[model samples]
Target: MLTRQEITILQELAKQYAEIASLPIQKEKRNMWLKLNTIQMERPMVLIDQIPWHEMDVDGFLKTKVSDPHWRGIEWEMRTAIYRWHHMPADLVVNPYICLPRIAENVGWNLPFHAESEVGQYGGQAQTHIFVNQLQEMEDIEKIQPRKIIVHKEREAEMLLEAKEVFGGIIDYRWGGFSSHLGFWDFISLWMGVTNCYIELMDRPEFMHAIMERMTQIHLEEIRQMNELQLYDINTNICHCSQTFLPDLPKEGDIAVSGNAWAFGLAQLFTSVSPAITDEFEVAYMKRIFPYYGAIYYGCCDRLDDRLDIIAKLPKIRKISCSPWSIPEPFAEKMPDYCAMSVKPNPAFLAGESMDEDSIRKEIRRAIAAAKNYNRSVEFILKDITTVRNDPQRLWRWQEIAMEEVQR
Candidate 1:
């Protein structure tokens, strides 16, 4: 149930959304295309840690003095690394917040509180408990049940309003994963540990599926609530989702992540796994859960180029992962239209190369030159990025490159 305040705000916002969403679908498509271009071309992403998720001294952020008035000049910092994504040639993921599930652990599952980067830095179990030997014992797993007042409600609401106020709508407070990004796999690896769950899959197949399906339902409900509230329609650039495997499609009726649509992550993950393994256990599953997100990337944060032909069949996918090792040209040629490219650079370049201006310049140039012929507009994401201690200047290259190209 929405609060009177929420209803009032949303009713007003709904009028704006109707105007926005009513723009010709082609125009919206063009807008997204332009946005994708902005990602690949213009505005260097300045990954601002606009929202510090480490149990923010929320009061401090809310009350702190802001002397700088310009949007570009607005002063802010984060507990963890945040790139100025607009200037950098990459996707802008609002830091620390992207890893929401881990953060929420700080507030307990039932409360509406979010997990802070402090909590994420520590991380947590995919499935909280391990070795629950009894069937009924499994029932007590962590979940944020519906129909209850969420905790941290005040913090979250306050943060949202503050961001909107200061940023003048530039700060996009996206509601990302509150549960597992991986469908059934979230519970298996989280609770049982990957190794333990793998063995159980073969040793106790039916039990494993039941547990995975159950966990998936809990997770789906979480996403469903977010979707119902129009939370998914926030200023988010893309409805981004990823996982390890994919499932095969089925002929007839099957319950999907949403009402009738299967989840895309499952389909992509299946394509990544070896054919023999998929044929035995995952083919049927992927076939059913292959239609949710508009854009999907699969496989080990690596270039899923090998899986492209299979993935291309996904009508809604608009972005595909391009790993450092993946051959860019062929994959670029192969990705069916509308699928933007997500390029995963070798993190070694960021850490290994000497942090001289020339070296950083060359690295950015080489990446841009290499990605010149990509299937769609490019997205350079640095996964496992940990350091920038002495290389603050390095972040500027991506944004500079995109700005230079877009103008040309």
Candidate 2:
């Protein structure tokens, strides 16, 4: 419930959002993203992101001089979206819909150790550390159960009606989260501490296999459950490794299944593991899971220079992530013609005492030169930016360099 003043402010923001979403340029940019994702010829795309907003140097980024905390939070998100559209180089859509979920909630059995991270003094960028090994023994795997999803039918309908009354003409209302981006190995690493999980892979191979087998089934069941509930919104276009639109979607009906949308997974915890171990544990299970998806976007922050071959072999793998540590030349060479190369440039370029324009240009040039070979599809996703050194302008400059390369 918003006060009259707050409602007025919100509706004004909604109008601004509507204006942007209705732009002719929006449609053109969208088509470009769709073509790039579908492995067609187009200029390289760019997606700039800063994971933790507190780490950014943008003054008053979050703070709004409002008495009501709820309205302030809403203002924060709306303002951030507006700021990103104006500043960042990403192909962001001004979706006027305030999307709400139709499904209830899924709560998993609690693991003993929680996911934790430590933020630095400069900016609130966290150094994550997981300290749990719930699956130390084979017998512990029995405790795993499929999450029960509860649908809030009355509440969902009430909210949708209220949204229609308040922002019906200005912004649309819709239900989202029909599809999912699930990762089996990523969850396993969290349940079992990363180090212990790695050691157990070598020590207790059978046990790891059993856990993966159960985990895969659990996810498959969960996905089917969404379909059974009829909460899926198939009309919404989602952005995964690529910007997916109506044209890129499968010809299937509106059902909540992996084959309906993009599925992304990453095992950054397995970054240092040997290829053999990787193949036995990670690759084998991923093959089982990825088959359910219409398209796949594999790897995140993890350097896939070593495991690119195995990942490239997966069914419907559309985008392969090239993290900061991955050498672009080899990644470009190995990236399948059918798939797009998604590059995650190092964010460290902006974290130093000052912006290193020369170094940044050189690195961008290298990536451009490598991917330009054979005109392979490429998208530069600037992510993992932990710090901006109290200067958000560095990000804008970096985008300038990247967009320049695209034109060249």
Candidate 3:
């Protein structure tokens, strides 16, 4: 149960959120995102990530005090959400109601893990030594089974009713898995260890193929089951792909299926592997998974400059991420017309002892110019920023520079 004080804090935040959502600019931004997503216009969108906040000072803003850990976590999230929307110049649409009581049907099963990292770390920015792999032997693969989506109806309803009572009118409640970042290749890397997985591709070719085949089956089955159960996941207005919103997507009432929402896939772990190897291990199975989605976003922080030929073959891939390491000049020249380029600028500009606005501005201008030289549809996503040296102003400044370059 929420305390009287917690409820008051939530109510206050909801009012502020409501004010932003009610802005006419919000709808304009929404329409612009729709245009950007459909590849009709070249409006550049800016998306600021939540990574830097982990190392920044948020003390002065977190005024709400809740003794319970869960409630305190909620308070902290609300504070961050309010701060980012109000401060950052990203192309974000502030909805009239905040999201509360969000829930997903627990797919009753667990992907066995052999190695693990400490929480709040290994967020893809830092590389760590793999210490575990549950599948140590070939026989262990049999333990992997198809997962079933277990919808806890009573618990989901109880939480929804409670949220409605608290801020039902002030904020909207969404249910089901609307956003997914689970790329089975990454899941494979997690279970098999990066080095071991790569080595097995050449050494134990048959074994690697077997594992990939099973992983593909599990992922496809999960998606099919979720849709069959009417698990609704709406991405129509959500910024899952760059800053672009999925305008023609499912609603909260529609059935949750891959055909209605955006699905993301990448093989960043296969960065060092040969394109042919990646085609067999990563793209081959991804072909099976990508067909299920209405639209797909591919590539992460991995450099895909050389592997573009292989990736172009995947189905329904609409946006490709041009990482900081990817050669922007050739990437701009080679980007396919059917898909938009999502550029992920190096996050290191925001980190370290001191921030370099000049260097940051230069790089942003260069990236933007490269995209324009080829008349490519592009969006700049500033993410994977591990730390900001506890400086919030750096991100704000970076956003300003990025937006300026976009408008230029």
Which predicted model would earn the best lDDT?
A: 3
Task: Give per-residue CA lDDT, model 1, range 1-408, as digits (tens).
Answer: 234454344334333333333335424333444565333433222121212222223233323233422111122222122223223423333321211111122222342322222222212211123343223234533342333213355555664554455334322233332221433454334445445555665677676556645544554455555445323222223333322111222113332223322233432333344544443444334343444432244433434555566656544454566656766677667766665566555544544456444544454445555556542555555554444433544445534544454334
For each candidate, the alpha-carbon lDDT, in order, equals: 0.40, 0.71, 0.72
Q: What is the alpha-carbon lDDT for the whole of candidate 1?
A: 0.40
Q: Alpha-carbon error at 404 in model 1, in Å?
A: 5.8
lDDT ranking of the models? 3, 2, 1
The estimated TM-scores of all candidates read 0.52, 0.89, 0.90
- Location of the lowest summed lDDT over 10 successive residues in candidate 2: 233-242
* Highest TM-score scorer: 3
Residue range with the least summed lDDT across 10 consecutive positions in model 1: 95-104
Local error of candidate 3 at 295, Å?
A: 1.2
lDDT for model 3 comes to 0.72
Model 1 TM-score?
A: 0.52
lDDT of 3 by residue, 108-184 (tens): 32666655663344334455655476665677776667777776677667757656766766767555355556566
Candidate 2 lDDT over residue span 1-408, tens digit each: 546776677677667667777788778887887788777847877767654466442666445544555345546656766777777746665554655555477655344456555444654454567565677677789778777778878766765665566577787755666556556666777777788887887788888889988877887777677667754445445544345553746464556555676768777877788867777777787787778777777778888887777777678787888888899998888778888888887888888899888887787778878888757778888877777776778887888877787778
Residue 368's lDDT in candidate 1: 57
